[model samples]
Target: MDIKLSNKNLGLTPSVTLSIDAKAKEMKAKGINVIGFGVGEPDFNTPDNIRLKAINAIENKNLGYTPASGLPELKEVICKKLKKDNNLDYEKENIIVSNGAKHSLYNVFQAICNPGDEVIIPTPYWVSYPELVKMADATPVYIECSEENSFKMDTEVLKESITKNTKAIILNSPSNPTGSVYTKNELEEIAEIAVENNILVVSDEIYEKLIYDNFEHVSIASLNDEIKDLTIVVNGMSKAYAMTGWRIGYTASNKSIAKVMSNIQSHSTSNPNTIAQYASIEGIQGSQQFIEEMRLSFDERRKYMVDRINNIEGLSCIVPKGAFYIMMNITEFIGKEIKGKLIMNSVDFSELLLEKANVAIVPGKAFGSDNFMRISYANSMENIKEGLTRIEAFLQEKTE
Candidate 1:
């Protein structure tokens, strides 16, 4: 007997980031020295205090399942965090903690999207947004963000993308793949559009605490109460607290939306891990000294990668304001042949890099842009230096 899968998932491609990261790990396990820029997670250890809390919970054996919407105490604290850090007030009823920020986004799309509804996702976006939209049976409309514009969406372009079927739009600041931070002024304009168009704005702010230099992260929901009602703010402990494995993320939205998401999550995963949720409470409320130190270290790596990538032949990148990624432009090397392997696109470029240089990186095609590739700078300084060196050498050897 033959089993055919559902058509909805037939077109879904595996995540290129995870694919490359896993390959690198596999290669490393086989004794290969692979430097991978494919993983988007922080490479640091989870903060000691937060880990200690997890240990305490485990020791106490309080691992009972949490509420489908998450622990009441955690929701209350998340509300305070919103008001304190994001300048947005949300009650416990407006919050729903899910497995991760990714899950929160999936719920946001599922809660709002109907069949054939259009969700405007800007590119080069995080690789998962369009797929998640598709998974929700919604159409993902793309708006290309250019290097000239610092990889941010133009208000005019956004206006053009919205049509009658446009039900929602995604806004990611300290954005993945580009490290572009949306300014408050820019958000005000987008908020105006969203409010005028009655579009639900799903704002992903997972990298809010990983900023560098003087960049201030502005929550689009904080622009005004009107936009706040239409916005679902997604965040988690992953990036800021080096807690990727913790799998705790949350969404703050209107009560109705939160309720729908909670109901959906209730039947699916039931609740996020009980211990991780408890640990996240401490991750947010505990001392934030770890954030600054992580930021400084990331800033150092960011500076080094930007300067080094720019100096290398056939590669250039815009300096990112926040997040741990750099979108390295590989346009000049697109059609070159390296070791008789033709470089047709970013995927080809990445494959050759991985095979020849023993370095793993996700192709930008996975992120809705093919002229570039993303490099995560969350690796150690030594790894960053060696990885760039390997990339430079790999590209340098390209011939006709």
Candidate 2:
């Protein structure tokens, strides 16, 4: 029998994280003790109050389908949260909820992009952005961010990338692969470029609440009225509220764009989970003390990981000002052999570390960066210590 696949399906690449996760599972099943760090999820469980709210909803028979866009109460709470936190004003109609920030973003790209349109994505971006763009039949134009610039896109490079075919640019703060948070000044410069080119800005602020050291997260839409109209802000409860499994995410944008996104959602997944929507309303409207506690914990772990990684003989890491992942440069260890296998690139390095040291880390090539690897600090303090110790010993054995 012959099987056929659509162009959309053929365009999509397998998820790199899932591939690593599957390999880790196979090794673990074979009795290898693997410290898996390839996951992009938080190690914490959903908060008790949030879980109870969902449970209460389920008990109350709130299991019916929701509005195609979202629950009215959840949408209202999201609007309020946006205004309170980001100083961005939006009516309830301007928001559309989805399964996760990932779903919301995929919908947004599907709604806005046309075939052959170019999306300017900064390199070392989230692994899914380029794939999603391709799935929409759009081209992903990479704007490389160098290590010297702290892995942030240069304004000049951004300006130069705009062409008539360019339709949008994706801005991810506290970026996934590299924990680089764009400063207000940097965002303003990028906003100027976006505004001038009439390019829509898809700001992924999923990690907004995960910042450290008083680093402010500025919404590009808040820069001015003009920028606001062209900016689509995507956020959700997954990272901050530890509700990854709940699958509640939303976006605030121009009313017309919001409507288009909602229409796309109507045909796609229809609506987010009803219980999750109810829980997310509580997540947004309830007390935020838990968020602060989590942020503080991540800050401590980030400092410890960066310091320890830098102390290693051949590995150098920059102190990330925000997110919980550290993109450490392992270029110094390239070309070296471990256990008779030569480490040629980030992929080879990650494989060697996993097989030899029993510690799993995501290679930077997944995020479009080659000479580095992302080590997430989202696990426990003990796990962080053990993982780093294994990494250090592995490197020492190779370099010595």
Candidate 3:
């Protein structure tokens, strides 16, 4: 007898980034030296303070479940954080803590979406956005954000995309894959549109603290009271505090939506890791010096990666203002023969580099763009240098 899987999940696409990273790790386990640039997690260890806090919790505090949504204390801390960092005032009633920002986003979609509703997503999005929308039984409307526009959704195009069926739009700043941060002006325009159209804004701000060039992060929710109520701000400790494994993520939205999300999560996963929630409280209120150090390190690597990739023939990348990934344009190499293999798209170029040079980078097709590939600078400078050197040499290689 055969077992049936959920039809929705069957149609779901597995994460290409994780798959590529796993393959690279498998090669490394087999003694192959693969320099991986896939997956966006910071390579730095969780800061000592945060780790010690977890230790302290395990030893001192009760490890029992907290509230279904999150610990009240943790929610209080998150509320304060939003006011201090984002200038958005919210009560604990409006916040829901989930396993990770990814989980928080999933909760948002599930709670707000209805069947046949449409959620607008900008192209070259984080790998999970469209998938999450589809999982909610909502249609994902794609808006192609061009490279020339720094992959940001333009207001004009956004207006054209909205319709009676539209339920929401996703805004990711210091965007994953492209590292594009929207300016305050751009967000203000978006805020106006959202308010007019009565569309919810699911703002993913997980990379807020990883921005560079002193570029300020402006939350679309902070623009006005109306927009604030219409926005669900998704963030977590994973990117900023290097707490990927801890899996603490949250969302700030209207109280009604938060209640729905909490109810949904209560049955699904229950309270997030109780120990992690306690630790996250400490991570939020503890010394933030670790964040600065990580940001500076990433900034250095980002600069080096962009400069080197630009200098190399047949490849180019725009300077990313925030986040730690570079979207290297591989269009120049398309339809050409490299190492006796025809390179037609980002996936072909990525596979060639991985097989021949042992450098693992994500093809842009994973992010909805086929003319580019994304490389993360979350690795050390040494590894980044080695990876790029290998990539450059791979581009020059010829077969007998």
160-278: candidate 3 lDDT, tens digit per residue? 99999999999999799899999999999999999999999999999999898889899999888999999999999899999999999999999999999999999999999998998
Error of 3 at 379 (Å): 0.5
- The whole-model lDDT of each prediction reads 0.93, 0.89, 0.93
TM-score of each: 0.98, 0.98, 0.98
Candidate 2: misplaced stretches above 4 Å?
none
> How many backbone overlaps does candidate 3 show?
0
For 77-164, candidate 2 gives per-residue lDDT tens digits of: 9988999999999999999999999999999999999998999999888899999899888999999999889899999888889899
Candidate 3 residues lying further than 4 Å off, grouped into runs, are: none
- Residue-pair clashes per prediction, in order, are 0, 0, 0
Off by over 4 Å in 1: none
What is candidate 3's TM-score against the reference?
0.98
State the TM-score for model 2. 0.98
As a whole number from 0 to 100, the lDDT of residue 106 in candidate 1 is 92
Can you write out model 1's per-residue Cα lDDT over 24-46, one digit (the tens) per residue?
A: 89889999999988989888899
